[model samples]
Target: LMVLGLIGAVVLASGSLIKAISMIILGLLLGQINTDVISGTPRYSFDIPELTDGIGFVVIAMGVFGFGEIIANLGMPAEHREVFTKKVKGLWPTKEDFKEAWPAVLRGTGIGSLLGVLPGGGALLASFAAYTLEKKVAKDPSKFGRGAIQGVAGPESANNAGAQTSFIPMLTLGIPPNAVMALMVGAMTIKGIQPGPQVMSSNPTLFWGLIASMWVGNLMLVILNLPLIGIWIKLLTVPYRFLFPAIVVFCCIGTYTLNNSSFDVYMTALFAVIGYVFYKLKCEPAPLLLGFILGPMMEENLRRALLLSRGDWSTFATRPLSAGLLIAAAIMIITVILPGISGKREAAFQEAD
Candidate 1:
């Protein structure tokens, strides 16, 4: 899974291998700086006691995206507003649009199903890859990003499919592919339930019930959204001052509920400021959250693998299957530097991004 994810990143990078390498190094550093619970040592705590617990992923995400989004929106002039269609029209797509979208949706579903099984691959990557694939396959690729129905339908379907299949790894293998699945694992642990292959055999009702709920949830969402879309649009038309405070209040409540810790609330406030700064600098906060969530797990696994191999670093490359995956990832990275391919890859990404 890691190899697959690395290959995806490499392919996506085009000629930007240096940037990819730096981002990885940064993630590794963040992971290492986090406190090791078993060792009870803080690597980058900077003599601050609050740092010992390490920064929470939920806090950072809320701060960077939730609060930061509100802050950024608030910075824009109040009179500036989103342009919306003045009239309400039928929700269904036209016949030509439907025809174009169905094939894209089917292709997206297939792509999402395959990628969702990989660790670290989730709805985001599935949507991204699907959109890219759709653009590549489209008869009029130039239509993408300018009210392209295929662009919307393909990614939306892929994300939904990816989200559903992501549960497979979590339920059957006790491995979470993303942060949400990690939370699901924690929730299962809290309920005195172990998640794995045994979950299906030992608790048939719970397993089947969960599976049924996904369909029910999808139906409910469609029914609810149809009526509420107008209300949502109306809410979007509301002034930022009126809306952002409500968002901030909800974020604070959610942050405090994490451990009922006022300290977390305070930390969230600090991160809100940091998030705003990042927003002003046009920096992305998503990778930091990913690093925070995946870092410790990566470190723990690396440590265990090394210990099992008696500290022999060659184990990663010595195994046949492992070597093949590594070689594939390496090849993808190397290809990004090739002359014509690099230019075209960069152009594709530049268009997409």
Candidate 2:
């Protein structure tokens, strides 16, 4: 619970506090749609059998990020839909650019490496945190959201580093730290490979090979991306009218295939509408996603802790580790809500506007 609170605080600091909290509350409510684990009774399932198993992550993700974005794009005026097709003179960075970027990259990597190990911390969280850190520490904070090289370098480096390190929890403890890692766990299960500490000893070859492949993959990306930049640029020239329909079709196909259920497709459409509402309200959906993912886990752990303590309700504070975590969470919330910090946060966001 404390970890989830801390994560929520970080997310809250990233944007408008009231909007973040509202989205998070909505996410928590949505997470309650399935059956209760402890009571073996239906929760907010509305007597629907299809909802008893809870909503799939893919459904929500595709609905909000895929269809919702498409809807927003379609709603905009045609004048706002112009693609940037300016010719590029150089693909590589200059020496001065490298010099400026390296320090940010190093800081981002360090931050990402640390955060990726935490439950629910992954590329998204790491990148957000890194960007916020860069903005806060920058000599001229106004440069952010204005083609600042530090803003780009920091977040990209953190994203890559966090993506690599997020495999740690899945590999060592069989606990996926993020959605991608959860998919990786599913893939490993299909391959008849259990993810845990035993894998290192029992399947050293597979374990070590996976680690080594990351380095190879990174090298391959650099080699391929440099030459493929033009192709990517050309892709942007495609009209939204031509591109969006294809994307919407693919999203529908993907959602329907998840369980071969038409209900899932309907649910996705519903959430897409909800997502569009959020978009209109300028509410970031990322924190809501984090809440949805962590909500059940937090409930389960809280229940287990209480059961073990015979419902004393003091186990959380009585334990040193949990106490420390709660303290940290409190400190983070206090820091974000302080008058001076809140004012600066608003100012920073306004600058971005």
Candidate 3:
């Protein structure tokens, strides 16, 4: 599934398959840093204690998506770098917009709810999947990546639904599905509330309260943000010269505070340079990020399966579910790589350009 997401990102988001693949490889290499979880041996730590623990996702993400983008924007011509400061009107969607968006929202919500329960599946993956699914199902797929209403509605809905459903595993099974849930688990522990099946019966108030809070929080966001849209838009009017520095400073501070380590700050800076290089190369970082997240999990699961099968390589194909997924992946790969389909895909994506 992760592989499929990465491939889709490369195909849909990044036009250059080779560049995206190279970035994914680079991410996989970076993911190899720190001690091997299975063998307890360091792979790419270079004898540094900080590297031994592996790089934090926050460091990579902030560097790549935040700092890197600032750098990219700074490099662009002044005219090209200007923010969209046009006058706003019609904050509400039209009836036709709702008609088109409702179906997409429903599909996105269903996809997100299902994916969110899986380990390592969260809002990011769900949003990407939903967006890709929308493109796949759209009457004129070329309308995507432009001003398509479905593009915005589907991903936003998916993201919210995925975020809400991600708590299920954490609350019911005492397993944190993602980093946020891990923090929630810690907080619950600190509060003397044990997570798991017993929590619903033993601490019904907390369990039910949390569920109720989700709905209330959603309503609060809608209430607060709708009125504040103009204010949010006004922020874009701020000069890039002032805005960029503040963004960089805050991001550095946030990265430093993540582990209270200067090493992470330095790592973030290093990745920022890498991200800038990626920007110059026109290589989309999203697939790389996905690869980095999924690489370790893939390795761990593969090792576990091998261990269970006593080193039998055929174990993957021997299992019906695993075989089906593998076959599906293979078909997707073939479909994307075929000359006829690849040419049409390129032409379709070219419309966005």
Off by over 4 Å in 2: 1-15, 86-89, 93-163, 174-206
lDDT of 1 by residue, 254-302 (tens): 9899878877788788778877986675444544444444567657777
Candidate numbers, best lDDT first, in rank order = 3, 2, 1
Which runs of model 3 end up more than 4 angstroms from their true locations?
A: 7-11, 85-87, 96-104, 128-152, 186-209
Q: Lowest-lDDT window of 10 residues in candidate 3? A: 5-14
Better of 1 and 3 by TM-score: 3
TM, every model? 0.72, 0.80, 0.86
lDDT of 2 by residue, 63-98 (tens): 997899889888999866645546655657789889
Worst 10 residues of 1 by lDDT: 6-15
Instruction: Name the runs in model 1 displaced over 4 angstroms.
Output: 10-24, 79-163, 169-209, 269-284, 348-353
Best by lDDT: 3
Model 3 lDDT tens row, 166-195: 999988999998889999999999999999
Candidate with the greatest TM-score versus the true structure: 3
Using alpha carbons, what is the TM-score of model 1? 0.72
Q: Which is the winner by lDDT between candidate 2 and candidate 3? A: 3
Instruction: Estimate the Cα RMSD of every predicted model relative to the unseen true structure.
Output: 4.8, 3.8, 3.1
